[model samples]
Target: MLPPELPPLPALTRAEGELIDRYLEVLDLLGRINPARNSGTYTGLRAAQALVTKAAALRDALTVMHNRGESELHGETLARALRVLDGERRAGLVTVPPPADN
Candidate 1:
């Protein structure tokens, strides 16, 4: 995730918050999945297990970035968060470009 602005608020809209919430839910689902299952039902879980790593990384990065001053984040660092958010959408954990315009 990109380094958050110095204040670390990120000015997220409600839609953006919802998207983040969805991604969290997906991550939770992945956490619930077990790696030892030998059945086909475990396939998606296995996939989730692998994919959740990205989400976990994003979560950690965001936590760190948010601790920074609001003005500290710019360009490349901010881009990283955008990329991770996009990855969340691509992974079907969240929706992209939120429906309502901010």
Candidate 2:
């Protein structure tokens, strides 16, 4: 089974919404590659996979909702974290953290 869907983040502006779409596109393209934010392990693999899967789900959800009029196309808060991660990736920082082996 797939992971649970996350609560949608509403885009507050057209600019932000567009940014979110761009960000999701980037994720769908690149989120699968493990950024190796921690020591390589099973946890890192899962985290990387989760990043790609969840992002693709959320991206699809947003697109469908926008098409169905269930949600705004431009949610300001949507993809805010993604914007941050985008910045971090551009800055050569870790994007996905491995789950703690507890």
Candidate 3:
């Protein structure tokens, strides 16, 4: 479930919305990148995964900034993204940190 503190997306500008879409695309692309863990690993793919994660965080932060009513949106989205990435990680599609201690 989305964070209740998250304000609606109505306040986002067209460009901002586009950025969010781009971030989602990045995530999709990340899923497509082969980890190639067999032969020395694909550092490029891992790098792309990190880049996409950072992009998503930026998108969420911008969304929250545009709508302060959902001050926790960025954190919430990051958490959800991490969960989705967990599935990807388990499938050997990407490598990220272990789940948060909390």
Best by TM-score: 2
lDDT of 1 by residue, 1-102 (tens): 986644333555444444455555555455344333224566666666666665765565556546543334354544444455553434443222235666
Rate residue 21 of model 1 by lDDT. Answer: 50
Question: Could you give candidate 3's per-residue lDDT for residues 12-71 as a string of tens digits?
Answer: 444444545555555554545544432334655665667767677767756765675544
For candidate 2, the 10 contiguous residues with the lowest summed lDDT are 85-94
Q: What is the lDDT of candidate 1?
A: 0.49
Number of clashes recorded per candidate: 7, 7, 0
TM-score of candidate 3 relative to the true fold: 0.31
What would the TM-score be for candidate 2 when compared with the true structure? 0.33
Candidate 1 worst ten-residue window by lDDT: 89-98
Model 3 scores a C-alpha lDDT of 0.52
> Candidate 1 — which pairs collide?
2-81, 5-69, 5-70, 6-69, 6-70, 6-71, 7-70
lDDT of 2 by residue, 45-83 (tens): 666666766676657756765776655443335445455
| lDDT, model 1, position 77 | 42
User: Candidate 1: where are CA atoms >4 Å away?
Assistant: 1-40, 71-102
RMSD of each: 13.2, 10.6, 10.1
| Between candidates 2 and 3, the TM-score winner | 2
Q: After superposition, how far is residue 52 of candidate 1 from its true place, in Å?
A: 3.7
Off by over 4 Å in 3: 1-7, 34-102
